[model samples]
Target: MNIQNPNRCFLGVSASVTGRSWADRLDARGAQTALAIAQRHGVPDLLARIVAGRGVALDEVPQYLDPSIRALMPDPDSLTDMGAAVDRLASAVLKGESVAVFGDYDVDGATSTALLVSLLRTAGLDPLFHIPDRIFEGYGPNVGAIEQLAARGVTLLVTVDCGTTSVETLAAARRLGLDVVVIDHHLPGDTLPEVTALVNANRQDDLSQLGHLCAAGVVFMTLVGLSRRLRDLGHWTADRPAPDLLQSLDLVALGTVADVVPLRGLNRAYVSKGLIALRRRQRLGLTALMDVARLDGPPRPCHLGFLLGPRINAGGRIGDAALGTRLLLTDDPMEAKRIAAELDRLNTERQEVERAVLEAAEAEALAATGLEDAGASIVVSGEGWHPGIVGLVAARLKERFNRPAFAIAFNGETGTGSARSIPGVDIGKAVHGAVEAGLLVKGGGHAMAAGLTVERRRLGDLRAYLEGQLAASVETARADRALAIDGALTAGGATVALVEQVAKAGPFGSGNPEP
Candidate 1:
């Protein structure tokens, strides 16, 4: 595959510095191996090389090409604490106890909540849910919210895409006799919260390599496990068919892509299946969204990430916090259409807010020492910046700086910061460390992304701490940067069929970047 424009900016400075040149390399051995694998798979040499070059085994070519969920689906029981989570839910359903799904305000959070809510509703259980207001609640479950759910008679609280670090909140729920099952992918703090079941691939003791999964993916697996257990419990009566978890792939796929997790193995299956489901136009809310976005053709990964996800997220970000889940779960087309239109308007507003924050953050980023002049990283905090758009601003800074970036939005004495990191630097771990050191009020995340709550007074301390922690890793990652080209080819060999074959490697992002 042809590489895109090279010599991009590095930390707000132009990449084309005087004598600096991009380090591009072509692997002839890998190309030859691809050709042999292609021959074995009975495919075009060009396509074979690309897939093989990506480390796909020769025996797995067909399955990889097909991207079937069944081929990639692991036993749900493989995830740690999954059985406990499922059993708790089944107990609630069997006993006619009430449930509440608490989720974050992002796309993954919205979709994760919707998937669980939909599945429970189908299984003859009516569920209440809460999507925390972005500005008011920040992230993860809070003690007050848990108490309110308990007062409302919600016996079991299911937190998806959040709650891994909620020691205080989960403790409050436990004291009130409210059960909690946390099915989240975020890394845990010093200790996991006390709950009915904590299902996280990233938990310290969990050996599941599926930490790359988004929270929605984690929820989907929970449903899979729940189904297996419910099937054993004879809950799947003839009238009440087991919820087809496959039908939910559309939400799983959207959340996976939107969260920017690595699209490999199960993730690939989810997106492959989800893209098909999306194109079917079966979900009225999504169909309305596509109509509003003027998506005339097939829905690609780009459409999901940039188009549908943002609109859904806009509801949680600026408009109604629960609007995303409502849109995703509503069966009424008129209602879905109205919500979709409102979300569309909110997304436009999100864009304008994002642009303004980005411009201001960019200026601050360029002005920061070492950041503007080949510094290890970028950390910019501003007063009264919109918290809703800080994450987006941090993401833009990440692209421009080619390194980990933090954009903090200060509200009086406190600031809520969003961080985006490059591959090697573990911003989440850094944030977690800060939290442990009593520097941050709270923080947790994966390698690529994280969030933090810090005092305005501690901003400098946090910056100094991160710079010291990340300086070495940042240098190593930057030194490792290079352009990966498949190989050289003659003019006659380049054809549409060859391009189509390379296209088979994608739905690329994060772990499966375009090759």
Candidate 2:
């Protein structure tokens, strides 16, 4: 077998049907490393190239292929506020104080809320929880919700997958004499919120370098810290054992994959181990969901992301936002089955609404910038559109147009918008900037996705602002948007044995593409 030159395009196909070039994923150095990997490890040449193309170092191949939780799990206290957050949680447990969890409406939020609630219940505490309505309460904690919890005699509030930007809301909670602990992963605003402990890994001052984690991942680490603290305080005994944190990996895996974070480092280990737990089908709610989704075989990341995630998300999109959390937290099989069936029906309804919105949004996007060139970014707004369905529309538009996109649902004076960004573009930062510039009422998210609110009159102004701010970066990203091919394979060269060897690299997702 002869190796092609690394400088040349794979199979000499410069341009494909997608109007994109096909190029070697491996450079000269990477090609040499692949050859070395094949020679040293005695693996198939294609498998070696795939591993090398993903930027795995020569010595790291063994660990990369086998991502163990013990090897990849970091110390819980490594995060900036883990200790302080644990202290408050432990105190709540010791004093048997009333606690409440305020979570977002998405899968990440539901899982985070469920995970925390499960841990608290194990410690002999019955914690109250809330999943806000997407349209009514919007994202993150709101004023009225906090006041309601405080009225219920809640002494401590723990917000998951939210609260990083809820400065005023958490401050209000503080005013009601409630201690707030925020365990989140979203980027923060200019001024940090005044809370008991904000245990976000993505905070500006955090040096954990664990920013790739999703909200559920952050919650898991916080629980680890809290569990340790509880143990130190003699909260566990023979009669009352500590919660088996491993059992909750199923939730972590669901949120981690559904949120679409980069599957690298700790995330890789999480999904790898979490799949093992998920395969056991121990969680009644998930098992019911699996049955409804017709998932007969073992669960994988794709199953979680495409099947189960959509059903859970359907509740937040069109139905009751609390349905997902209720489904995940339920211990009764009958209740889980009922909620799962309702979610399945809701998902079908959501698909119809999403398709209608996507069709309208695509037409609007095309008319805004004809087929010749789809400008730097696209901003599409429609009257009377479902606000909950805009995120799905924005994602579809971004994929179809190959750039950043925002789908706005207008209702008279104001509009709710959801944004999806391309590789190099930072839509979250752009939203925050728009907020600071008074172009948007409020917005916040991570790099790949975001949500925003703006006055209907300022739609054009927001579009122009985004184009000017993101043009250079979008152009640079699109210029290099070639499809990366590790190696070309002939029909005769493909074999089952080769594929089996490639299976060494398991659980691929956003950052780790399947070969």
Candidate 3:
């Protein structure tokens, strides 16, 4: 190993960013079944190898590559309370009762709300919807908003991408004589909220393994459940047929990619189907958004996540919280265009806000390396840091340090922030642990990301606890870290057809990384 550039991979291909070559450490023949698969399937050798390297079995290759909703969709009733949730929703739709759908302010939340809004309108029910202001209400439903919706003659309330953890808020709604259906994917807490139905794929007792589903996916399944239940009940006559779930896959795909859930299992099918739907551009809102984003081609996961998701989320970050939901739910092209332009401007503003936090957090991150106990995770805090962009800062720090990271912003009295984690380290559980330890005011999240609040005075304890908690896992993951190269190629050999072939292995994100 007398290599001059230890950082650069020299497998006759691209090297690691630090100029390191993990090629020698890579097991190129790891996908030994790929050759046989290629021979049997009559496909390119590289394609088979790429699929095998991604852990797709030979028997699973066809479905893995060409995911179909029919082949992969799970029974929604298999999830707890799914039937009850659908029944409740159907009753509201049929009776023409005033209904409100509440969602968080993120892209997942916005899309989830939009999906429900679209479905309800199609069913001839004009639904009332609410996307809480991130600055005022933070995440999940608050007490005041519930009361307002109730006062607006809302007989039923449906929560999308949120409300699983709002035990108290839903309880208050219960007292107000409001029927509530909770459709969320976040890991649920002990003693679920007392709603009309609590339908979550990630419910502690769920065996569906649909925990990988983003909120939009979960919401889409609920639509399927509701439609089937309605059809079974003869609610849908000849004129009013079932609302087509396929038409809404675009929303599901956008939220799925933007939320950064692993594109595996049903998620893979959803994205595959949704991408096709997106290409059709039947949705007026999506077409308007693509125009404003200047995307002159079929929308891809990258366009959804990086280009469009940011603009949708920009409203939640610095502008009106409901802008994204409105943009997605509207059928009017004029309204869509107006909102899209406004959101694009807001996204630029968000970049500026994110940069300020990134610069300050970068300084703190660099300064930490010199400390005696730098710990495994990056933790940075500063007064006057905008809570909106803390997650972006955490992601930046994590990328820079190749570890888990958290950025807390102090607003004199309280600190609210976000956390971003690497593959092996579960920052969601870490935040939950901190909250359980009474180190945080309240917090809950999934494997990779989370949000929390704390008393400004106890910030030091929260930091220390997270450091101690994640130190072992982070160190262990780093110690065992080894990049596996799928294959190698020369610059001249990388043709357009080859690029297309390689792309067949993707739709990759958090868990199912690009090969």
Candidate 4:
């Protein structure tokens, strides 16, 4: 409401620079109409104006700000293959099969694994969990993981957050007679893997309108389906209490924010409910994490994104990602406290490493451009760079340059790279192209971020390839980096009441970001 940051560049509302000018213009038009409506309805002018500016229609006003899972959530049956996945998982639970959950190392993956593991155990299934090592297992389902699980007599493998792109790994699981149920949110390639059931909102044929959900959200939907199936099959009695989906929403909220997914529809509901659940302090690990992070109030989206998420991810980046997962899933308060403290320490260390990497990357970019003036896109690499922090550095470079960027850390033979991109350019496509050009050993991701492994000798080739691909995209992105405020406001509009009114349009992020 104050609308201006004195220390930062202030691009006025409807400025030509940022494409957000359209949002400002739309806000102005809505504000005009809102005034008329407010007078006619005898409503608060500020609330009406804020609601209008957020594109919340009169019909949606009641629900937009106050997210209700019952109203906003779509039936799990609408998701393709959800019924089959649920049936298979329910059958496995009834048969007392040994199940294993395979997940990635990021926050979303960790939370999803925790949620599924907890839910499955509640459903009477003894489930073991595995989170891939960032440096050793190298993201997603691996053949070695499948073999290890099989060796441990795991009959059914439930993969969360990853495994959509793991064709070979799934194939290995099949060869070992392990049935796999994949519940991921990553975009699937043309060829689908042979698995017991694949449940992902991002599948091209799946039109559930919840594709923006993160892995934890997907896992939540799976739980809903499984719970319903169990209820119908008499496996769960009505008086036994519901699965307590709300209790797990905290994890869903963390994953949704950390994965940078759009907070709309079901996602908004999850975050709204999850925030309340987080404040309840039910989960010992989460409570300890909040204490260590110095968060006293209810967890907000920014807290998950900026403060808590980074600390949880810090373990995966430089240390073991499973450490964060263990902390989130543990029941022992003392153990949770110890793990939270260690993660907090690791996060501090991670920050220092990120600072150093960013400085070196910026210097390298300036040198590459030859005039101490790099263009919109920044692509940098360094020998002995920390692999865990490359993604963080790429995000920083993207913010600094206002264009797509990549940062790679090379060891002797292998170079692990992470990338972040602007809205228009697809970083995933760039990673795919690098793979197609034989410049990368493996690469994949969504539009905004991606990861790849390259030979150290091909670092120059990777940089050149990205530069060529980003040439025109960078120009357009740089021209659109300016910020646009919704409208000019007086001190009256900056009150806590107005903040609350504006907040009704949240939980904002990615596609459904706050205006």
Q: Poorest 10 consecutive residues of model 2 by lDDT?
A: 1-10
Go through the candidates in order and give each one's C-alpha lDDT: 0.85, 0.90, 0.84, 0.81
Clashing pairs in model 4? none
Two-way TM-score contest, 1 vs 2, winner: 2
After superposition on all CA atoms, how large is the RMSD of candidate 1?
3.8
lDDT of 4: 0.81
lDDT accuracy of residue 185 in candidate 1: 94
Worst 10 residues of 4 by lDDT: 1-10
Model 1 per-residue lDDT at 466: 89
Number of the top lDDT candidate: 2
lDDT of 1 by residue, 1-515 (tens): 22222542222232344434333222455556677787788887656766776677777888778888777878888888998999999998888889999999999999999999998998888999999988898898888788889999988999999999899888988899888999999988888788889999999788778988999999999998888888899989989989777878999999999999988888998998899898899888788889999999999898899889889989877788999889999999999989989999999999998888888888887776545475667889888888887888888888888889999999899999899998778989999999988899888888999988999888888888988899999877776554554455799988888777777888776667676
How does model 3 fare in lDDT? Answer: 0.84
Candidate 4 Cα misplacement greater than 4 A, ranges: 1-58, 238-241, 370-376, 512-515
- The residue-level lDDT of candidate 1 at 348 comes to 95
The TM-score, computed over Cα atoms with residue i paired to residue i, of candidate 1 is 0.93
Q: After aligning candidate 1 to the native by TM-score, how far in Å is the CA of 75 from where it should be? A: 0.9
Q: Per-residue alpha-carbon lDDT of model 2 for 1-515, expressed as tens digits?
A: 11233355777777799766678888788899999988887778888999898888888787778888778889998999899999999999999999999999999999999999999999999999999998888999998998999999999999999999989888989999999999999989898899999998889999999999999999999889889888888889999999889889999999999999988888988898899998998999999999999999989899999999999999999999999999998999999999999999999999999999888888988887975588889899999999989999999888888889899998889999899998878889999999889999999999999999999889889989998999998887767767788777899878888777777786888888898
Error of 2 at 435 (Å): 0.9
> In model 3, which regions exceed 4 Å deviation?
1-19, 24-29, 370-373, 490-493
Full ranking by lDDT: 2, 1, 3, 4
Give the root-mean-square deviation of each candidate in angstroms: 3.8, 2.4, 3.2, 4.0
**How do the residues 79-170 of candidate 4 rate in per-residue lDDT, one tens digit apiece?**
87898899889999789889999988899999999998887878887799998888877888999878998999999999999888788879
